[model samples]
Structures are given as C-alpha cells and as structure tokens.
Target: MSYGDEHRYGESARADDELFGGSGQTRTRLPDRAGDPYGGARRGGRSSSRSLVTVVGVVVLLIAAIAFANRGGDGSSSADDRGGEPAGAATAATGKRPVTTKTGGIPSGFTHDAQGAQSAAANYAVALGSTNMFKKDTRHSLLDLLYTPAAATRLRGPMDQAYSAEFLGKVGLDSNGDPPTGSTFVSRVVPVGTTVQQYGDSTAKVAVWYMGLIGMSGERSTDPVTSTWKTWTFTLQWTGGDWKIAADSQQDGPAPVPGDDRAATSDEISKAIDEYGGFTYAR
Candidate 1:
C-alpha cells in the first residue's frame, strides 16, 4: 500500500483489497455510525460475542494504563523505579515506540530486541491468519511479504494445495475464494498478546495468542460465523533488515471457559466486523 492509498487495518473487505489483494467477492454494507465514519451505521444489539470484544479491548488498555502508574508513553521511569522486575521478565507495556514506516500497510522494520520480536509476532499472526490466505494472488503477495524468500519458496506449493478448491468448497467458498452470492465470508485473526520464547541476534522464536473468526454470514447460510482460539508460534529470521517467517506452527489454545453470552446474529456479526477495524498491534 502506498502512502497515497487509503490506510486500513485488520483483514476485512476494504482493508484486504487495499493491502494485499482481492480476498473475496463480497462487499460490506455499513449503514450506521453517529459520526458517519465511511458512512457506517449505528452499532447493533448487545450480545455476549460483542461484549467479549469490548471487554478485551478495555482490559488491554487498562493494563497499559496501569502498567506503570508513575510512567507514561514517554519512558521517564527506569528499571530501578520498576521494582527491579527480573532483568528479562516480560514487563508491562513499556510505552515503547512502534515503527513509523509500513511495508504493504504492515508495520515493518522492527527493532533488534525482545520487544521487537514480540511485536513482529503479534502483527505477523494477524496477517498470516487473515482472509487473504485463501486467495491465490493475495496469498502469493502476502507470502512474499511475510516470509523469508527461502521459506516462501518452500511453502508455496504446500500452501496452495492446502487451500485447494475442494477444501474451499467444504468451507463454503468457491474456487476463487468467494462466498455464495448475497453472503459474506468472514475470516479474521485478532491477537490477544505475544511472548518471546527465545531471541538471538539473527533469529527469534515467538508465540501469539489469538482469537480467530471464520464462517459465512447470510440469511440462509448453513455455516454461520464462528470463533476459535489458538496459539501460533513463529520462527522469525532477521533478513534484509526485517523479521520474516522461516517456519511456523499452531496448537489448540489456553481458551477461557465460555461465557453464557448469546451468539450474535449473522448480520450483527457481519456488521460488527465491518465497523470495528483491527489494530496495528504495537506495544
């Protein structure tokens, strides 16, 4: 994405097209918003699903806000003032500055440190698990962008086979990665947090905890939108001054017990996803 192009975050209809490429055939309809952001409509009814997202956002912000009550985005406080947390223990939000430039709308040029590894892991998780992974063109573009050249060459064929037409049909999408007409296919990855398992001058192993949404939204759709929890561990290599994936794996998550919240209607789920953009996921 160029500086002149519209900026976006998260993999939704417009964002993916602008950042990666065509992800699907459907378009979003945002009917309400008091301020009319992109002509968006007012938010819909309350549901456990909606409340969960809101709560998570509040929690993350609250933690960052209270992480160092005496400190701020500007790092005025030192380790001596931080109760001397173990030298390498993951500290609360450090108010660390994020990279200012972007590559394909993806934050890039991470620092050479543990904090940089964590940030790269979180952002990469979101990009990899995005809807763009389904389409061939965008998938290739993304693989080129997110993976080390050698990794991209190694995974191309396997990834293409994995998202074969038959697999897409089972997931209610066409060979072209489009949902049935009148329906919207939803695929998004929302990162919860990141942790560094190992870090070195040339490489890092990092894990990302995330919640993913995948399904088709339509009045008569059989596969309604749903969510899943997983942790993705990525092996990142420092190449060309960027952290690119060398290898990655995923596993079932430490998912929280489900709350007694009613699932949102398809329209509600669809609208909510369209209205709420994803974050750049920085410290």
Candidate 2:
C-alpha cells in the first residue's frame, strides 16, 4: 500500500553511493554454496561439481549484468529524477520550487513546457469528469477556466444542453441534479499516468489515462457503480506564463478485462464516496 521511503523523483543518495562503491573499492567474491553433497567426492564427481559451480557462477554474473544494464549508466537520471521542468532544463531544475498554485480553488500555474502540459492534462481530466459538471453554473465556470477562449463559448451551450434536467433524471439525480434525500451521488476521476505525444515552445499535446466513477446509489438504483478507463488528450498553449488547454477530446481505451470482484452494496458505495475527498494531481 505504501511506496516505501523512496522519493517520487527516484533520486536516493544511498542508492547512488551503493551503486558506485562509495568506499573506493569494489567487493569481489567467488561463487560457492555451503552444504553441497558433492564437496568430497570421486575424481569424476569432482569434475561434475566444478561444472555445476561454473554454471551457477555464470548465472550470478548474468544477473548482476542485467541489473546494471537496467539501472542505466551511473551518470544518467530517470524522468522523474529530472523534476517537472521543460525538457532541456529538466535536470538542473530537480530541486526547484514545487508547483502548487491554485486558480478558483483548482490547482494551476504550471510552467509552460512538457511537464506543465502533463500536469494540466491530468488535472483537466479530473475537472471534466467531475460530478459538478452536471450542475449548470459550476459546469460553465469549469469549462471557461479549462478551455481556450474560442472553445469555451462554443462548448458551453452544448454542454449545458447535454446535462439538462431530463438527462439528470435519467441518471438518478433530481431535476436540480441532486441525489435523492436518502441516496448519494458519486462521480470521481483518478489519473493513472500522463504522456506527451508532441512538444514545442508554445504548444504541447498530452494524454492522460484515467479511471472515473459515475452513477447513483440506492436500493432502486440502476448503473450502480462502475469503473471506466478513458484517455483525455489535450492540446495546450503557453499563455501568460502558464500552460492552458486549447482543445481537448476524450476516448475510451486501454481498459483491462473486468475482475470478478463482488459488487459492493449501493449504500456502502455511497457512504465511501461521500466520506472520501478527491486529490489534486501533478506530474
């Protein structure tokens, strides 16, 4: 459940020292195992035992070689190790200030670059899939903040019509898009990872893979609780020192085969959703 003491950046001073033999000498050893029955055998038996030892030694060496190769060269750093900066300045910015500014209670102010595009994509997926979008006022505000100026006005009316009173009722919400008195509404989005497909000085294309929760909870509920995998792709532009989405689209994807886990009771799902708060994501 825990990711251990390793930092998110993948840079551990202890790991580095261990890999390079910080004490100025590398340890060496011969391959041998105790309690071998062939230790004191006949001449032919001794030869066979030597062969076995040789095989074991080779296996050990191969494993060590593979480990070293996988770790990359000692001079290289991983993507996470380079910190969330534009690709060129990434390594030098490793210990730079964290990006944690908020706009209208939503996290924003990402640097204008690949890392910034990734962070924006992840957060935008959450906002777009949120339950608040079902309400008229909140939906408009969220769209205006997230989309480019041209797209915002164009999408607003269509989105409002899509989440109309009739649509809300079909989804188990009242005319006002609220759950019944004894029931609970649950909609949440969780980001899995981000990828930048294209990058430039002023624009970037990023995709976020995410799982979302939608549906209502009650004895008479339909569409009880389900998980969906969606890829949200964003075209982002640098404007006023921050990365902002220009256009975005969603597509179903890369979903795993469903598990056989038993479905939770409606009430349980409702209670859990109500009790838990969502996260503010960053890449």
Q: State which candidate has the highest TM-score.
A: 2
**In candidate 1, what are the lDDT values of residues 1-283, reduced to their tens digit?**
1000111112112221122211101123454455533564545567657967987997798688656543443221122222222122333466666677789878899887666777887888887777787799998988899888987886778777777898788778899998888788888888876655555678766667788888889887888887788777677789898888877766666577989999998889878878988887764
Highest lDDT: give the candidate number: 1
Residue-wise C-alpha lDDT for candidate 2, range 1-283, written one tens digit per residue? 0010111111111232222210111123464565665577556888989989998997899899767644532111223222232131111222333267888767788876566677777787787777777788887888778777766776676666666787788788877778888777777778876665556678666667778777778888875767777666667778777777666656666687998999899978988987888877665
TM-score of 1: 0.69
Looking at model 1, which ten-residue stretch has the lowest summed lDDT?
1-10
| TM-score of decoy 2 | 0.70
lDDT of 1: 0.67
Colliding pairs, model 1: 31-41, 32-40, 32-41, 32-42, 33-40, 33-41, 33-42
